[model samples]
Target: MRCVVLPGVYPPQEDTLLLAAALRRERLPPAARVLDVGTGSGALAVAAARHGAAEVTAVDVCGRAVLTARLNGLLAGCRIRTVRGDLLCPVAGERFDLVVANPPYVPTPPAPRPSRGIARTSDGGEDGRTVLDRLCAEVPAALRPSGVLLLVHSALCGVRPTLALLAAAGLRAEVADRALVPLGPETRSRAGWLLRRGLLAPGQEKEELVVIRAERV
Candidate 1:
């Protein structure tokens, strides 16, 4: 399949398509401004454009990924404003009515994988909650009053704790979708072993992606 990320950058464009597709089907209000965090290959930004969002802002920490996202936006005929900065760093002065993030949720490092963004961010930190924690805290500030924030993360990555954290952050969250997939031998060997031993069940090759939307209250 054609990769979504630019050559040599990682996080093939195909990686974000599933979540991007889901965002495309959303019914947005008039002239809604949407922000996509961790926009590795610009998949979500392009998808937001396709979904009829009036303004789309996509950000990534890696410069190569930012350039790739810009090119993808151009190729897709979308005017996604690409920003080179860490999460919420570049877009400090902006707020969006709708925000979507496929942030580096994967906290665990990949087992010699081709792309790092897809697998590495999969580590949620110790209990797979690091990235989610930042989202829970920063997302609210990045969203407009009454804005909607959509987040997709692994259930094995402390999904319940993530929900609780969101609530504590003053955002009311509700699950939107979930999917489970099997783990690879290498990952199952490295991270999965700890998870399988009655622990946090992290690093599972077969795991669920829980789609959740929280409104800034």
Candidate 2:
């Protein structure tokens, strides 16, 4: 797909493609509403639109990301409503048939998350569930009954907890997909901290990526 990714906006990566593939497997109604949270370049939004979602909305906190997603949607010839705000904040009181997210799941040290810059795209709190947890908690409210949520994150962040949270939110959740990928730049930079925290073993260079599928039943 042709996409315009500006500086500081995240480019499509493994997790993005994984979530997109999982998205295609979903059975979307003809006029289904789709929400792509933390949509970096609108790749998943475009995919959802292409797969028959009548209304697709992409949300991001970064200005560059918002522009990039809008541009990519235009370039892809898909109609995507792009909004700039924190995850799910812009779409209050709205509901969707499908919600997709590939949020920041990298385990960084506990500290105030960056308010701007590229770091904001990948910095998750200490255990790496900062954004993931919030998404799991808030997304259920945005999902219509029988709606589905597809989220991608690293196994290092703990898949079971995510499942538990989603289940606690009344969604029937399960691991839909998994893949082992080599650590990227951000993960490599935090290798020492991760090792010290016992989140990673010495010489470990790969992490498992997991896609959690939850349905509001």
lDDT against the true structure, each candidate? 0.71, 0.94
Evaluate residue 88 in candidate 2 and report its C-alpha lDDT on the 0 to 100 scale. 97
Candidate 2, TM-score vs. the true structure?
0.98
Q: What's the lDDT for candidate 2? A: 0.94
Candidate whose lDDT is highest: 2
Q: What is the lDDT of residue 196 in candidate 1?
A: 53
lDDT of 2 by residue, 1-217 (tens): 9888899888999999999999999999768999999999899999999999999999999988999999999998999999999999999999999999999999998778788877878898899998999999999999998999999999999999999999999999999999999998899999999999999999998999999999999
Residue 32 lDDT (model 2)? 100
Supply candidate 2's per-residue lDDT for 116: 84
State residue 37's C-alpha deviation in candidate 2, in Å. Answer: 0.3
Off by over 4 Å in 1: 1-4, 7-15, 107-120, 184-189, 196-205
Report the lDDT tens digits of candidate 1 across residue range 23-99.
76677888999998887777788878888899999887777788988988888888989888878888887889888
Residue pairs in collision within model 2: none
TM-score: model 1 vs. ground truth: 0.82
Give me the runs in candidate 2 sitting further than 4 Å from their true place. none
